[model samples]
Target: MSEDTTQDSAGFATRARIDTSRPHSARFWNYFIGGKDNYEVDRELGDRIKEIFPGLVDVAVTSRHFLGRAVRHLAGEQGIRQFLDIGTGLPTADNTHEVAQRVAPDARIVYVDNDPIVLTHANALLTSTPEGRTAYLDADLHDPEAVLRAAAGTLDLSRPVGLMILNTLGHVADHQQAQGLVRTLMAGLAPGSHLVICDGTATSEGMIAASEAYNASGAVPYYVRSVEEITGLFDGLELVEPGVVRVPEWRPEEADDAGSGAPVDAYCGVGRKA
Candidate 1:
């Protein structure tokens, strides 16, 4: 299905214009994950960055795994029935709704993203269980208040909501602002609400170099913050077991040790708002 071409109050298309002339974060990431939604320009930049950091593919793939595991834990163990997935990237396998609904068929989800391409591909994101509901909103991350208000139409703000902000905060250049955005969103949710965050870290030189190259691509820049800074986002919340560890290291279900000694370039954690 294609994106809805509906116009917003601003008279501009709610979905982002498909500017194949430049690389977009969603499409670039899509390219990294081996999805066919990206363009030639995105593929070119993705290849260039891969040359700088071959492990990026690992980071991207591992981060996605982290998302799946977090959603499963929330749905299966925590009994979470609602999700607010901001900066929802290109629709890939095992999305938040897919994972959550699989465990709890009545899980409701609201996905927010400003990317027009993603908006166009929103049909892929609209899938939901017969007992649940799913909706997409074209909005920016900087405006968390608007995001919450829009999401409230589909999610119950007075109940526990799992806010997922995976691989998206880096777009906000100001660390403090990013934290503030998160805090503002969490403040709107009721107690027992959960926050699941995962983003790339500046743990390796190669990853840092790749980030730099991507920043130079004229697209929005993404910052790879330190682990301490990433952990700081959950200051007032209760972290789950093995708090704020590498993405692949976050509660590995199997003992094969795919992440035991390996240093992943991303950090993730699940926290509950008290």
Candidate 2:
């Protein structure tokens, strides 16, 4: 819980200022995922949300599983080498680069986040395969062009890249702008680029209650959409098999570990630009 706000030389991180007065999205996510990079405030809010919706911890874990599955599909099966992961929360097990690089050592990844705490953890994220590369951007997702421009230093935009915005779009309350931002980013990538997304939905009373409580918390509000609305985010892209299903339903690992067969409120999909 040290409020360390160091920046890298790329200026991807601005002033060293870690404001712990209120819970932030990245910190809360870290707390939910059981990472040690969060403060008491984050853990308090996370616990409160769990009280409102006990299944939130499950949603967080399964969403991470979806990330590993999606990245595996893109890197191992689809042969995608470059990945643009926006809204990458605190680094944890099976991160985008870790998952992708494990499959294909030459895979390049660029992680973007506007949070400075994430900036402080950039060193942990910047570790990449000598055959590949990884970079972190302290940039905003609302501006796709700038992200791409900054990413161009590491990724070849002319080639197919996997664009991942998992559990991030909900932070953008404006529906039209969210979809538009996605399209803008996709439009910039080459054909066959993949887009991976997963976010919580108002699918259950518990989830709805959880969303309400989280919104009331002083932290940034995350809007959960309906199934149809969530699925529509990939309107023009060609969805992969078993399209827009629950996170666990998407090519889950063949393990006997079944936390609960009951569906979590989170929805996700992986689509190809072509």
Clash count list over all predictions: 3, 0
Provide TM-scores for the models: 0.93, 0.93
Q: Which candidate leads the pack in TM-score?
A: 2
Q: How close is candidate 1 to the true structure, as a TM-score?
A: 0.93
- lDDT on C-alpha atoms for all candidate structures: 0.89, 0.89
At residue 159, candidate 1 shows an lDDT of 93
Where model 1 places Cα greater than 4 Å from the true spot, the runs are 1-16, 255-261
Candidate 2: tens digits of C-alpha lDDT, residues 106-163: 9999999988788778889988999989999989998999999999999999999999
Give the CA lDDT, 0 to 100, for residue 260 in model 2: 65
